[model samples]
Target: MTLASQHPMTMFGPDFPFAYDDWLSHPAGLGRLPEHRLGTPVAVVGGGVSGLVAAYELMRLGLRPVLYEAGELGGRMRSIAFADHPDSLAELGAMRFPPSASTLFHYIGLLGLATRPFPNPLSACTPSTVLDLGGVVHRVRTADELPTDYQAVADAWDKALQDRAELSSMEDAIRRRDVPAIKSIWNRLVTEMDDQSFYGFLAASSAFESFRTREIFGQVGFGTGGWDTDFPNSILEILRVIYTHADDDQVSIVGGARQVPAGLWTRTPGRLAHWPAGTSLSSLNSGRPRPSVTRLSRTGEAITVEDSSGARQDFAAAVFTPHVWTLLGRIDCAPELLSVPQWTAVERTHYMNSSKLFVLTDRPFWRDTDPRTGRDVMGMTLTDRSPRGVYLFDDGPDRPGVMCLSYSWNDDSSKMLTLDDGQRLAVVLRQLKAIYPDVDIASHVIGDPITVTWEREPHFMGAFRASLPGHYRYQRRLFTQFMQRGEPDARRGFFLCGDDVSWTAGFAEGAVTTALNAVWGVLDHLGGATAPENPGPGDRFDELAPVDLPF
Candidate 1:
């Protein structure tokens, strides 16, 4: 008898399965631009991870990238720091990341960033977990101790995913990186399930016949938190997360996720192209990015951009990496820039709302054991209440600790949307008191709470895009927009990138991979070609393109 373990699963997609990580690490660089096109100016709107990646690679190819940022660099990867506690950080945006995000990890490795396992609920990194639902609290070290009914609900969801979605086979194909098998299984699912909602998929499954079972599954989801808000979203979205293991084996950056974009901005690549050895994106942009781009339009053959400073620059190409709403509502754009179908997709993009509240504590007081109970005073808490999820961070016994008081999404997030900072803190603290009556979290609090509601942010109207039922067509149109092989020459120069423009939205892996796609688009537009040995995404576009569905 023989046994062979499965290969590690990367975000090598069923949608577009080009090995971006391979292309990046190849001895031959991404591609080369013509001698005449060297030093050509390109507009990169928003200084987020996507924008910075595109800009950095563009600079490496001997092109000039003029970045315009409406807010601070790093976009949704925001980390709030307090004046007194420099060691603690309140991650208002992206806190945890999955290790399967190879493209993003590629940048993390290059930046020399360190990562540790984030304390997810019932995860190995977490000391203990308290699950509170319907005013009942149950403390446990793992899911094994939960009631048999809880296990039943989990088993039901697993059965449905396996039977209805062919999850096991699909995951096996993904682990093997079998392009034909991945495409075969996925394209069929796309055709059959494009119009199906997450809730509908469960309802159709015989294992999840009970409404109560479905409800339990929604409140306490598989790896992350609640899934009730995601019920209305397309089943394909959920399948994408599960198939690629986007929710499993997650880790947080040692310092914070914001360091990724900041590092890219400041880092001088070891392998320099046309630019001098010491040059970097920060150096090229005069130490900082340009102001917000107020207007975008085509002037003859060039893409003209006007910033908040009233300075205008005509570039040979442009890459947009913000939420589509920023372009549609905030910035003025020429109608001729996109096709009619592309405009509809942008207008129809649905985004999920997210809210997070964090507080600095005096010390790791939660680690204090109760004399009577012999358990830590408090554990990472998950409740059906408004707070939804509470995470505790312990640096050391001597140093201060951080507590993520509340993390909510969609309906749960809406409840806290109108509350002020004090009100937000009070709400979560009150909820925690219900679960941990013996412990007083307020007594340990050292500073005012830090909070952010993604929906309230002017530049980013929503947290991230979540395609609703029947949005597969829209998702396809936007993701494939970077391949403008048949577009008019004037319109060809403009391209789009970001998680919003990617199949796997809401994950940074999507953002970075889409940036690679746009980089390939910009290269092709500038009369450049990737080396035959290590072809870019566009180089293999025709062979590995996503399956086209009838409109």
Candidate 2:
């Protein structure tokens, strides 16, 4: 669309306002090189989706940027493969997009990545489900099917989803930055939806008491904690939950999400530089300061970043895109900037744990055989009684059969990730055996299981930011503030952009959208002595395009 619409600052969701190609080719200036260049004008920490988008947007604005990744660049958006069937796609974290994620579809198309409908149909089918409240198991599918006392449990879960649909309709007003109305609605919904955690919500439901029989055990038997055994918290809290057991649209890019950054990195010219191999940020050089930067004292201006070897150099700005939890308490920002109290709720309390496990088989184990009339074989989990973690989607014609993925959250993935590949494969095989008691898993085993846990890596504590009880308002503040010379700009110069800053909460779309905001901030910082005559937002950035320089 027009540049005004593309201004990152005003946008609400994850998708970048401009086309990907236009973003890459946006003109940046030349001829302002410092005597000795260590890093670019910007230093982007952590090369996950947000950091990658930020670096790409900065380069498009004609500014040199240095991207830093302590480990792999993709962060959590990764695809795993089983050793026996290396070709099979085992989605570790997010695997599919809901209809709400249209922006994700647009960006995927822009990248030229091929996408088919998700393989798991289990997400679509309303199967009988069991809720594991503590050690009890309660099965409930529909109101008519509800066990004696627990009919209300079934009713509440369904009603909560309906309420969320109503809440989402208020998006436009919220994005207008109308705090009061939004807060009122938020409180009403939370009180109604979250009187207790999901566990207690279901247990306390009048209908659930009917199902409390000796054979039935407890009312809901889904997740741990007293939260609704099967339903989890209201759909609202479940989506907001920091752990991985989120609704289906958590995404996984085909050919791996790393391609996103790799693609962006390739688009930049030589002005873009990365740390040399085997070097870490602690070893970066401290040399001549950037002539263009004037806010920091000599000590505040630069820090020493040494390589494994003795060599080092100085940098201008360091743009950190690492997980916020890891950076908190570790990175030393000015005391005034640290106004938000460190997150401390049971959920907010920091924990360094994350994991992804990929399970693959020779054919779709769930597919019912019917040679004469081949109907769609796989079933989607509209809601279910089986293990809660398995998600299946259509792999498309290019790949035969179905590709099913299972995701676990919090410390739940520990046992799965720790198993040897063979053991992990066996575990999945055993579970498959439960579904098809007659089939021999040994004959169907096609691949060894594969897994990755971000919590294991010292560089990152977990996936993207999570919303604690009161962090939403502060998160909005993070997006609006801009960094200034003597004081934090009314719009804080050190701006925040990411899922934590977007309307989507925690998704790739949020990161891309926030980057759009950061780009305009940089432009606003250097636009001119006086506001450019036509500086109306996104479109005005084009009018202030930087001078061309020979690469």
Candidate 3:
């Protein structure tokens, strides 16, 4: 195969080529609505990235956006600081970001936040990586240093991507934002691959004939670690991830990922339509968002939102950005808000359970060299042990540091859901001791351990959405909710926007792009139009829309 054919294509997926941040930053501003609609109020539920982006953009377009959140402002992008060392943080939600997430990076850059390359397994940022599988330890400084069999497994993955997915062509189109090329390549793949699972794709490929190779690939995946949990998920989802290089060239915010939304919450816009020159999202809400929306009732043209405190308010339109399950169960939503198909889509949405355990360390002791071997005592680790992945965070020699003792998902996370902090710590410590007998991890631990089981959290039932095989139709219905305004006024006024509603779930970029989609929806609903020079995603949605698969 030629060089181009040897690589898998990168796909922008449903995000397409729309640059939402650019549209919002346009000189003319998001197309003007009539003076009568300028001061109209709109309700934005779930004050996470989606809600914040929607509210901020709406406020700029001369609309009164009333934002509501049940818990913290950052939502899943939460970054918690240690009680003893406030400067350091342990990310409970999103930690790393890929450069392909242009929408999110736009906000990050606008906020002037600094980012450093994430120390993914076998990456240069990681001094070393230990792959402990089947009671065998393979420590390597790079992928080339891995055992011959492991190297073959990696090569097979690359070959499979090229042969089966057209990864190179897809990536080229995505990088150039070539909408036609992307659609031409991706539309065909959707028909061919939507119904398939990641594991099925692997099985069908010629890259791995032996079960051992397949098992090794699933058990110790490239980039972060094992991806066996994702095997049963839609191949489309996996394609989106690999195509966008979501697992490569990763970076994390200097302080925390949460700052992206938090910064936008308080940022002073360059242009203003109705609000004052220096008005920000926080100023618009008087520095406090309204309580969580407990109920949503639609009467004729308006939506009445009830908060946890029994307070009710009516708005011209409403945006729901919370997890689908929350909207389905936590809130007393009127059935008319969503169609039966939409409700079924929401009910059947699958969310992956994720858990993370972190501890504050006195120093970056892991960087110490082993006098005997002349290698760093501790590095990024991936093992079949209970603590599947171990990551180290160094904040200089003077300041205290943090260590993610264990980061797991699904059944692995479920195992630790009932364990207390001490118990979780003990489990991780024991696992680490087996992996690194010479390294004393427990001795460096300083403060109380912090752990989270996202599924158990009341506000967020799960960490992120992961679509199962044959669920493309359901996802399509969910994603296209922003455009379904042809019906009764009730359904027209209530819109859905979130990561779960996006084609690319579990990423901040998904939340941002979907929020922008809702912004355009709300704009069009209120009789606002996008400027011809800078058209929004809704403007070209049909041409660059997702592929429609036949069930």
Candidate 4:
């Protein structure tokens, strides 16, 4: 796509009309350009979604902004492939966005990228889950439909879901230092529910049929790690996820998840600079003064960025958008700016190392089931494949069930990725048999397990950021106070924006939200200032919405 055809929502923002060709054609090649000023008004660092979105928003306002990305533009939405099996693809991180993600949907529409709704639920319990949960299950079918043995299964499920919400609210209150209040409510529910998992809660409730008791147990049990233990969350969290999973329409990008980033780079008009083929950031400046940058530098003056060949050029503001933990203490910044240790404190947040295995076969390996359930043949799992967690989607639009991708997490994929292709294929075959006891795995299994190593990606140390016990308040406060461009008059004019810095935690939407906040904050600070005369073509800032304080 050309500059003229770029999305007006993004193209004309603060960082528009980037020297498009220069940015992509070479790795570290910033290319030959005229001697512009030292810095513009805003500098956006890291070229991932957050950086791209921030720059795009800024450019829309007609601001001349400069973006710096140490590596490929898309931060974590990258895919991987096996050398021999180039046709097969595996997502290293961020497979798809749910339809309910309004922020993500809005951006997609603005960018004109086509999104295809996923035909399957986020996760479908597999047979392994069934086996693990010992199979019988129940639901609050209806008042009259209720089994004679149980008062009402439906009523019980509702009660449990409500109880969970109550628990979570109490937990949140306690975190806010409401100890007396927490103690008052704790006994009421804690005494009523005690320490029962959802499975145990329902089984002993006397509100379900013997069959339903077993089946519901199986459904919530193996599928999500047996409720309480596997999830360890309030019942509210469980119900919310269950409802969202059921109603939300999650979908994958047309070209693959990685295509989003590729599209951004292709669609955005920015100067592309490639470093010398084999030089690291350290080698670029051999014993010279590395440029001093404010965390949120806002001078409306351009700064020279020297590539490995010692070539230098300038652009207005720079925005930084990389992983909070990885970028912390690595990039140059004022010492006082490093006081926020929240990034380092939560480094060990529960993260799963995952491997996505895509297989191509001519036959429909999955048996068709209830159209609503979409579990015709195979089941999914949060546990080892069975009923706990495995999902299947029809690849009909692509090929004849020719492409199948399975995301294996935790110990399920740990040892498998290290093996040779032949060995990995052998294990997947075995596991598939466990998921579909009736299917012929050995006959039509045509591909090896394609892997994407989360542990290997340098910028991303783990999978998505997760909130563990006692971390919610800390997370909310961190994003609330620290993620902003330094005040224009402050000693350090810097702003941090990324998915890690948003309330939504680990998702693309968070990146946009954070970027939006950063943009508004910077714009407000610079609203009173004037730009240099003869600013380059397509350089200005669009009026952005005022930043809304989160309640």
Among the numbered candidates, top TM-score falls to 1
Kindly provide the TM-score of model 1 when superposed on the true structure, using C-alpha atoms. 0.98
Residue 326, model 4: Cα distance from true site in angstroms: 0.5
Q: Model 3, stretches more than 4 Å misplaced?
A: 1-11, 14-17
Q: Per-residue alpha-carbon lDDT of model 4 for 357-400, expressed as tens digits?
A: 55545455654453665544443333334213343434453443
Q: What lDDT tens digits, residue by residue, belong to model 1 across residues 1-551? A: 11113477788897988889889999899998899998888999989999999999999899989989998999989987866877689888888899889999999999999999999888998888888888878877788977788789889989999999898888888777889999999999999999899999999999999999988888877687668879999999999999999999899998888999999999999887788899999999999999999999999989999998999989889999999888787999987888888999999999999999998889989899989989888888878988888999988899888999899998888998899999999988888888888888999998798999999999998899999999988888899899988798666788889998998889999999999999999999989999999999988888888888897
In candidate 2 the C-alpha lDDT for residue 124 amounts to 22
Compare the candidates by lDDT and give the number of the best one. 1
Backbone clashes for every candidate come to 0, 72, 10, 96
Candidate 1 error regions (>4 Å): 1-4
Answer with 1 or 3, whichever has the higher TM-score.
1
Return the clash pairs for model 3, or none: 7-168, 8-167, 8-168, 9-166, 9-167, 9-168, 9-170, 9-171, 10-170, 10-171
- Model 2 has an lDDT value of 0.42
- Compose the digit string of candidate 3's lDDT tens values, residues 127-164: 88888998899888999999999999999999999998
lDDT of 3 at 383: 84
- lDDT on C-alpha atoms for all candidate structures: 0.90, 0.42, 0.86, 0.45
Candidates 1 and 3: which is better by lDDT?
A: 1
**TM-score of model number 3:** 0.96
